[model samples]
Target: MSDRRLDDSEMATWLPTIRFVQLLPQVLDRTLKAETGLKHSHYAILVTLAGQGDRAIPMTELAQIAGLSRSRLSHAIDSLEERGWVTRTSCSSDRRTLTAALTEAGRELLRTAAPVHVAQIRALILDPLTDAEREQLGAILAKLTPGVAAAL
Candidate 1:
């Protein structure tokens, strides 16, 4: 095992990344909750559905896309449905399968929520970085995110 400790530069880089990883979700949750009466998780699910072609996806596929378990996704969907933000339908080709779709209300919610979400993201994440740092951060995150997702 290497006895080498993190250098000052390494510490500087790692500290913010660690703190951001910890703080970002809370910040996002706070913003989304305050602005839209929704949690960040709920907003993410709604955005995923809204962005999809036809605004529908199979339950299992949606869960995978959202990085959620089937039960968790189902519960979120249930909450959305209760809010009239989404609806579930039997798949026409396979009655055994189900699809979740954003309703008109859901799309409208997304429209209202997106600007707030983007603003929060800019304030908390993007605006802090210098242009070069932002570019570097984008490249680094793009490179690393897939590996992180794969692990999840």
Candidate 2:
């Protein structure tokens, strides 16, 4: 493979974009943990489960949707289960597979956290952008998602 380095124009775009990707999650995670006593990962899991309409999802599928490894998802679920926020049970048809379901407490927590989280997201990300810029950003990010997922 050729050891081609990024040109100056490419660097200009890539550096800031990569830095934002790295730093935004840390900032959001810290804020979420401080306000809700949950890390960003936990918040993501809860959000995903909440969106499933009270149905349980297989652990593997949950891990994929949550962008977590199976072990990490399992560990997080363990903590959530201990806190009465989530539950894990054997899948009815496949006894070997475990499914995770959000508990009522989890739903309550999510309801409480959603407003604050949405506000934070707006303040940190969307509020600064103009309507046109927001649309452009959505389009740009949509273009990028598939490649990033494939790389992963």
Candidate 3:
């Protein structure tokens, strides 16, 4: 059997959407590395750990929230630890459970990095959209996210 080709209407939407999805991350990563000496993945890990405040998050949970595999998260954590941006501890409730928490330096890093990220986001995405378009985009992504997540 042959696959059906996308018609013009579908191509019009999919082409730009796919291109933007593929390109935007690279753009952000380049900007992040240039200004902050961090890649987008490392930035994501820092942000995730920081979100939990004074508490440490278990490795499994952190991996899930960061959308990274255990091994990948482990490597990221190791790098972050080297930078004093993150620290890992054994969960007191379960000694075998390794946990990660953001450090003062990590928060400091975020203080520096978040603005760069936000500025890029505003310049690239939010600023370009009108209020209604932004609302519609939010709605559209909300509708699509579940199925996309389920597939993963």
lDDT at 114, model 2 = 85
Tell me the whole-model lDDT of each prediction, alpha carbons only: 0.90, 0.92, 0.94
Off by over 4 Å in 2: none
**Residues 95-146, model 1: lDDT tens digits:** 9899999899988998899999999889877898899999998999999989
Tens digits of lDDT, candidate 2, 1-152: 77999999999999999999999889889988888888888999999999998799999999988888898999999999999999999999999999999999999999888887899999988999999999999999999988987775
User: Backbone collision count in every prediction?
Assistant: 0, 0, 0
Would you list the rank order by lDDT, best first? 3, 2, 1
Worst 10 residues of 3 by lDDT: 143-152
| Residue-by-residue lDDT tens digits, candidate 3, 1-152 | 66999999999999999999999989999999999999999999999988899899999999888878899999999999999999999999899999999999999999999999999999999999999999999999999988886665
Candidate 2 clashes between residue pairs 3 or more apart in a chain or in different chains? none
Best-fitting candidate, scored by TM-score:
2
